[model samples]
Target: MAKELLKGNEAIAEAAIRSGLEAYFGYPITPQTELLEWLSRRMPELGRTFLQAESELAAINMVYGAACTGARVMTSSSSPGISLMMEGISYIAGTEIPVVLVDVMRGGPGLGNIAPAQGDYNQIVHGGGHGDFHPIVLAPASVQESIDLTVEAFDLADKYRAIVVVLIDGSIGQMMEPAELPPMQPIQKRNQEWAVTGAKDRERRILSSIYIDPEDEEVINFRLLERWNEIEANELRYKEYFMEDAELVVIGFGTAGRVALSAVRAARSEGIPVGLLRPITVSPFPYARIKEQTELACGMLVVEMNSGQMLQDVLAAVGGKIPVEFYGRMGGVVPLPDEILAEIRRLCYEPVAPSANPRISWMNRMNITKN
Candidate 1:
């Protein structure tokens, strides 16, 4: 297939259609609004379902209803919009319903800018809703990867019978790039015995998140934990660059990861030994790979588009064995490649005052976040 230029949001919508997306329920939000708009026209033409709900909450609940009927359903929104859907997401997770959610994140604690930011890391990856559940979060660094991962998100959501989140920053969502769309996948029939489509000649199916008995709730939690463990073991995914014999490793994800990789190459060209590790699956988090790769390096640098959200995860993975520094630009500002390269060089050569704790000292000098 010939590659066509497309905006990140358009690419994602096209990919979802090809992947047999049976239904989409979403509210218009900046950076992600294009995704909904594109699908609105295309989905109906293809005889699929698309609805613009009155609110993000309503949209997510619609997705919940569609998913219960064994439909491949999805929803898209930005930061505050996604926040509105948390209650519904928790219900979807608890019910073990298969669905996909696209979070084209923008800045903010509340109604932040419509610019690119990875500030939603904690909210999406750490279970924003009230429960002990984790969604399979996929962070795509480029437009092409966004399309490919959208398809994978649907497949994994169905395979695990759980919610999957395609977490992309605004930079990736609104930016245009050349992409080859995936082949059309055969539409999967939704006439499953588990579906609550109408109890005709079969046992009535009940899909409920509520567990009346405390023990039943505990049992549900246990089963979810087991499934999460299996996903962690089998679904951990990441990418490595120039790690064969490196003195420093840079860690990032989403758009920040793409920028960090460019910086790594620029530093390498200048004879500085630096590498990069990007977590493709943010929830499972590639902690084992991070530890293994950074163990031999002098230190690690975590570049992000937020105030060190993923930095905490990097710190946990390294266990303070080696110095881990952080640099980020919050509230929609993105850090430049030169800035990341400078930090990488400073961590490698600069000598600074020592602190009571090595981790503190490591972050004190390099951890800079722009407001």
Candidate 2:
């Protein structure tokens, strides 16, 4: 009802609770530990389940088991911790159960730091585990968005019988902002015909990811692909700013997108025709929208907190119709508005050729020597 100054991690935890989350299983991990900590106290008080598992591996499997019973279960972790849960995640995907995962990303390729970074974009959006399935990934730029997306993740997961990931960086997880949380939803109990509740007095129902026959596994793969097609068609989402009659466009997501917006505004004041396109849904990326922008914009600048992970997707969407440039800060380093503003200026005055590799150009600009 009223807005409160809330930390991102705690807000997301509370939002999940209000959305009728039935169980939470997670281990303590930096940047996201507050989420697990908040739930540890709140869940039990509400007579719901909260557990600090032995490890990230154990935590994900616990979520897997709980979700099998048609419960609204979730688990949260940082980058390295999420890596540990990949195999279990693949299992859940193969079994076709709805589960919510919150990944508050930190600097990493391997346990880098507890600072903010968007390095896990490829891992989460592209599917890290061994699978032919696509997980619905939503990226939020602010605490309010984090809270809202947390609630949406559950609904999307259940609707598609798929995994839905609410992805944000450590900065968003740790920052405080004034935001309104949704009212607590009464938990609705429904008999899930597909769940593995005791098959007492009825025909036994079995749910398993294992398919011994190649033909059967192929069938499963087709089913997953068909569902993914539906997601791509119905779920593409993004935000645009100053796009009307702009010739140069900038694209980013999450914190990087937020930072880019400021840069775009500064450039606009300087008489540059620059706009911003921020994708809220990273998976099932807004390819069509980006393609449409190619006709209106002369060029684009892709910005991120990593080494241009989303840049690849932008390239695919643009399809060589226009030149695309990239600028990024890696290893937990967040780029400033000024930095992106400079990139926007360059994109306007000295555009690169469509055939040029943006990442290498960026590396050269940053003075990073090729090995």
TM per candidate comes to: 0.95, 0.98
- C-alpha lDDT (0 to 100) for residue 339 of candidate 2: 91
User: On a 0 to 1 TM-score scale, where does candidate 2 land against the true structure?
Assistant: 0.98
Clashing pairs in 2: none
Q: Write the per-residue lDDT of candidate 2 for residues 1-371, one digit (tens) a residue.
A: 99999999999999999999999999999999999999999999999999999999999999999999999999999999999999999999999999999999999889799999999999999965897989999999999999999999999998899999999999999999999999999887757788888989999888889999999999999999999999999988888999997899999999999999999999999999999999999998999999999999999999999999999999999999999999999999999999999899988888588899999999998884335
TM-score, structure 1 vs. true: 0.95
**Candidate 1 residue lDDT tens string, 1-371:** 98999899989999999999989999999989999999999999988899999999999999999999998889999999999999999999989889999999998979988999999999999966999999999999999999999999998998888889999989899999999999998788857666788888888889999999999999999999999999999999998899888889999999999999889999999999888988999998988988886658878888899878888898788887777777787899988899899888887797433222434553565544311
Could you list the CA RMSD of all candidates, in the order they appear?
2.1, 1.6
- The CA lDDT at 39 in model 1 is 99
Kindly give the stretch of ten consecutive residues in candidate 2 with the minimal lDDT sum: 362-371
The CA lDDT at 248 in model 1 is 90
lDDT of 1 at 365: 52
Off by over 4 Å in 1: 351-371
